[model samples]
Target: MKKAIGQILSGNMLSKALGLLREILMAKFFGTGDINGAYRIAQTGTLVPINFMTSDSLNSAFIPLYKKYLAEDEQRAAVFKYCMFLFFSVVSILIFSILYFQSEYWVKLMAPGISESAREMSVSLLKVMAVCCPFYLCSGLVNYISMAHGDYKPMSMRASAQNVGMVLGVVAAFYSGNYLYLAWGFTGSYVFFSFWVVFRAFKGEILNFPIRLETKEVKLVMSNFWITLRPLLILPLILQGNITLERALASLISIDVVSALDYARFITDTVVFILSVPIAFAGLSEWASQTPEQVREKIIKIYYWLALLVINMSFFIFLSARDIVIFLFMRGEFNEQSVMATTHIIQGMSIGLWAQVVGYIFIKALSAHLNNRKVLVVMVFSLLSNAIVNVLTYKIWGAFGLGIGNAIYGIVMFLVSAWYLKIARSLYPVIIQISAGIVIYFCVYRFIGGYFNESTSAMLRLLVNGMVFFLFAFLWAMLFPFYRQGVIKVMTRKRLR
Candidate 1:
C-alpha cells in the first residue's frame, strides 16, 4: 500500500509541476481577459461530459472489476478489452450527439454577457472542442486499463501531456496574435493528448481494441456502469448549480464580468491543484488499500497534516494577494484595471482555500468508501446554497458579489463536510489545531503589517510579511506536541525519505 501511494505521489507531483509551468505561461501571456474566458467556457463544455463518463464514473467501476476479472481468469482480459470498446462506442456517440445539437445553446447560455463577436467566437471554439470529446472518452478507457495493469507512470505522463500541449498551444497563439488560431491550438492539444494516451496504452499492452464487441462482455460492462452511474446520476444537478449561477449572474453584469470571473478562477484553481493533488494522490490510493481500522487511523493523521498545509497555504495567498496579482499578471495589455479586478477576486477566493482543501479530502474519502449517495446529497445542498448566494450577491454587488458568494459557499461546504467526517470520527482536535494556527499566523501578520511604512513597496511588504507569518506558523506547530508528531509522520514517510 505504501509503495502504491509513493508511485501515485511521484507521478502526480511530476504532472503538477508541469501543470504549474503551463499556468505560469498562461498568466504571462493571456493574463485575465475575454479571450481566456471564452477558452475556459469552451473547454468546460468539452470536459463536463468527459468527467462524468470517464474519470468520475469509469474509474470507480472499471478498476475494481478489472482487478477482479484479472485475478479470477487470465482469459478475462478479452472480456475487459471488449468491455472498453463497447463503453467507448456508446459514450462517443452520446457525447457527439449532444455537442453537435446543443453547442450553440450552451455557448449562449454560459456567457450571455459577452458581445456578439465574443459569443460567435465562443460558439466556434465550442465546435472545435466538441471534436475532442471522443478522444477524451477513448483516453479514459486507456487510463483505466493502465491503472489496472499497475502501470501508473504511463498514465501520469499521458495526463501531463495535455498541459505540455496547452503550453505549446498558448505560445503558438501568442506568436500569431489571433484568438481564433489560439482556439484551434487548444483543440489540437486535446486531440494530441488523446492520441498520446492511446499510443502509450498500446505500448503497455494494457489496451486492445477488439475487432468486434461481444454481447456477454457488453452486458458485464453495462452492469458495472449502471452500478456506478446510479450513484453518480444526481451529481450533475447537485454539482453544476454554482456554475449555473455564475453564468446567469455574469450575464446580468457587463460583458467583461464573466471573463474576469473565469480568469480569477483560473488563478484560484492553480493554487488548489498544487495543494490538493499531492494529498489526494497519496491519501486516496493509500486509504483504498487499507482495512477499515487502518483506514480510520490514517484518515485522522492525514486530516491534521492536511489542515496544517491548507492553513499555511491560505495565509500565504491571503497576505500576498496583491503582489501575486502584480507578479503573475500585470503584463502587456493586462492593465491596472485587470489587476485590480483580479486582485479583488483572488482575495475573496483566498478565504475559501482552506475549505476547498478539506472538502476535497472528505469527498475522496467518501468515494473510497462507496458512499457516493451521501456525497451527492452534500453536493446538492452546497449547490443550492451557492445558487442562492450568487443570485442575491450578484444583484447587490455585481462581479465582486460573485466572488464573495463563492467564498461563503466554500465555507459552508467545508463545515458540512467536516460535520460528516466528524460523525465518522472525532474531528474536534483537528479543528482546534487549525484554528490555533490561523489565529497565530494572523496575529503575526498584523504585527508585521503595522511596522511596514506607507512608503514601502506593496510587493516588498507582502514578501516580508508572508515570510514572518510562515515562520511563526512553523514555530507554533512545532510547539504543539500532537501537531509536531503529525508533521514528523508526514515528512518522514518512506516515499519522502
Candidate 2:
C-alpha cells in the first residue's frame, strides 16, 4: 500500500506541477481577458459532463465490481470489461454529438455576461473540445482496469502524457495569443494521450481489442452497474452540477470574475490533490476489503492524519495566498489587479478547503461500504447550500461570494459526513489541534512577515514565512506522541522494505 501511495503521489505531483505550469502560461498570455474567460467557460462546459461520466461515476461502480470478477475469474472480468467499454463508448459518442451541436447554447448558458464575440468563440472551442469526450471514456475504463490489476503505472503515464500535451498546447497558444489554438491544444491532448494509454492497456493486457460482449457475465455486470449507478455513482453527477452552478454564478458577475474563480478554485484543488488524493487512492481498495470494524479503525487513523494535513495546509495557503498567486501568476498579461482578485478568492476558499478535502475521504469510505445513499444525501444538501449561498452572496461580493459559497458547501458536507459517521468523540481532539494550528500558524507568519521590508520580493517573503512555519509545525508534531509514532513507523517501514 505504501508503494502504491508513493507511485500515486509522485505521479500526482508531476501531473499537478505540469498542470500548474500550463495554467501559469495561460494566465501570462491571456490574463483575465475575454478570450481567457471564454476559454475557461468552454473548457468547463466541455469537461463537466465528460468528467462525470468518465471519473467517479464509472470508477465507483467499476472498481469494486472489477475487483470482484478478477478475484473469482479472469474470464468473467474480461467479459464485464468488454460490456462496460461498449456501453460507455456509445454513451460518450451520443453525449459528445449533442454537445457538439448545442455548443452555442451551452456557452451562452454558462457565461451569459460575455460579449457576442467571446460567446461565439466559446462555442467554437466547446465544439472542438467535445470530440475528446469519447476518448476520455475509453481512457477511464482502461485506467480502472489497470487499477484492478494492481498496475497504477499506466494511469500515471497517461496523466503525464495528457499534462505534457496541455503544456505544449498552452505554450503554442501563448505564442499565438489565440484562444482557438488553445482549444485545439486541449483537444489534441485527449487525441494523443487516449491512444497512448490504449496502446499501453493493450500491451499490459489490461484491455483487448475486438472485445466480445455477448457473454453470460454481461447481464450480471450490467445489473451491478445499474444498482451502483443509482446510488454510488450519482454523487459525481450532483457534484458536477454544483461546479456548473458556481461557474454560472460567477459568469453572471463578469467573464473576468469567472476566470478568477477558476484560478482560485484550481489552486485549492491542486493542494487537495497533493495531500489527500494519493492517500485515498492507496487506501480505498483496502477499505473496501475490510470488515466494518476494521474499516472504522482505518477511518479514525485516516481522519486523524487528514485533519493534520488539512489544518496545516489550509493555514499555509491562507497566509501565503497572495504571495503564491503573485509568484506563480503575476507575469505578462496576468497583472496586479488579476492577482488581487485571485487572492481574495483564494482567501475566501481557504476557509473551507479543509472541509472539502476531508469530506472527499468520507465519501470514498462510505462508497466502499456501499452506503452511497448517505453520500448522495449529503451531496444533495451541499449542492443546495452552494446554490443558495452563491445566489445570496454573489450580488454583493461578486467572485468572492462564489468562493464563500464553495466554503459553505464544503463545511456542510463535512458536517454531514461527521454526523453520519458518528465521529464526534474522536473528532474533538482534531478540532482542538486545528484551532491551535490556526492560531500558531497565523502568529508565526505574521511575526516573520513583519520583519520583511516593503521592497522584499514576494517569493523571498513566502519562502521565509513558509520555512518558519514548517519548523514550528515540525517541532509541534514531534512533541505529539501519535505524530511522532506515525513518522517513525513510516520511516522504519520504508527502511525495512
Candidate 3:
C-alpha cells in the first residue's frame, strides 16, 4: 500500500507539473482576453459532462467488478470488458453528437457575459472540442481495465496527455493567432491519448480487440453494474452543477472574472487534488462496507495529518499568494491587471482550501459506502450555499466573491462530513497544536521574513519567507514536551546506530 501510494504520488507530481505548465502557457499567451475567456468557457462546457460520467460512481464501480471477474475467471473478465467498452462507446458518441449539434446554445447558456464575437468563437471551439468525449471516455475505460490488472502506470498519465495537448494548443494559438487550433489541439489530445492507451491495453493483454462481445457473463455484469451504480446517479448532477453555477455567476460579472476564476482555481486545485486523491484511494477499502465507528480512530489520525497539511499550506500560500502568482503567471500576456485579479482570487481560495480537501475525501468515502441519497443531500446543500453566497457577493467582490462562494461550498460539504462521521470529539487533542502552528506561522512570516515581499526576485522572496516561518515553527514546537521527546528519541537512535 505504501509502495502503491509512492508510485501514485510520483505520477501525480509529474502530471501536476505538466498541468501547471499548461496553465502557465495559456496565461502567458492569452491572459484574461476575449479568446482566453472563450477558451475557458469552451473547456467548462466540454469537461462538465465528461467529469459527470468519468469521475462518477460508474468508474468507481468499474475496476472492482473487473477485478472480481478477473480473479474468478479471465474469460468472464474479457467478456465484461468488451461489454463495457461497447456501452461506453455508444454513450460517448451520443454525448459528442448532442454537444456538436447544440454548441451555439450551449455556449450562450454557459457564458452570457462575454461578447458576441467571443461567444461565436466559443461555439466553434465547443463543436470541435466536443469530439473529445468519445476518445476521453474510451481512454478511461482502457485505463481502468489496465488498473484492474495491477498496472498503475497508465492511470498516472491519464490527464498528462491532455495537458500536453493544451500546451500544444497554446503554442499554436500563439504562433498562428488562430484560436481554432486551440480547440483542435484540445480535441486532438483525447484522440492521441485514446489510441495510445488502447495500444497499451492490448500490449498489456488487459484488453483484446477481436473478442466475442456476447456472453452470459456480459448480461450478469451489466446488471450488476447498474445495481451497483443506480443509487449514485444524482452525484454527477450535483457535483457538475456546483462548477456550472460558479462559472455562470463569474460570467454574469464579466468574462474576465470567469477567466481569472478558472485560472486561479487550477492553481489551488492542483495541490489539493494531488494530495487528496491518494487519501481517497487509501480510504476506499475502509469505506466499502464498514460502519463509521469501526474506522473512527484510523480516520481521525488521517484527518489530523491532513488538517496539519491544510492549515500550514493554506497560511503560507494565502500570505504569499501574490509572489506565487507573479512568479508563475505574471509573464507574457499576463499583466498587472490580470495578476491583481488572479491574486485576489487565489487568496480567497486559499482561505478555504482545506475545506475542499476535507470535502473531497468525505465525498469519496461516502460514495464507497453507496449512500447516494446522503451524498445528494450534502451536495445539494453545498450547491445552495454556493449559489446564495455567489448571488449575494459577486456583484460586490467580483472574482474574489466567486472564489469565496467556492470556499463556502467546500465548507458546507466538510461540515456535513463532520456531522456524519462524528469525529469532531476526537480532534480536540490536535486543535491546540494546529492553532499554535497557525499563530506562530503568521507572526514569523508576517513580521519577520515577510519583509522579503519587497525583494525583486519573486522566487527568492517566496523561499526565504517560507523558510523563516517553518524554521520558527519547528523551534517553537521543540519547546513542547511531547515533540521534544520525539526529537530526542530520534537523535538517541541515530547516535546508537
- TM-scores of all models? 0.86, 0.93, 0.90
RMSD of candidate 1 to true structure, Å: 3.5
lDDT of 1 by residue, 196-241 (tens): 7777777876665545556776677567657755776767644553
Kindly report which residue stretches of model 2 are placed more than 4 angstroms away from their true locations once superposed: 208-216, 440-449, 484-497
lDDT of each: 0.67, 0.79, 0.77
Q: Give the candidate order by descending lDDT.
A: 2, 3, 1
Cα lDDT of candidate 3 equals: 0.77
Query: By the lDDT metric, which is better: model 1 or model 3?
Result: 3
- Assess the local accuracy of residue 472 in candidate 2 as a C-alpha lDDT between 0 and 100: 77
Count of steric clashes across candidates, in order: 0, 0, 0
Which runs of model 1 end up more than 4 angstroms from their true locations? 1-31, 55-57, 73-81, 208-217, 281-286, 408-425, 440-444, 447-459, 486-497
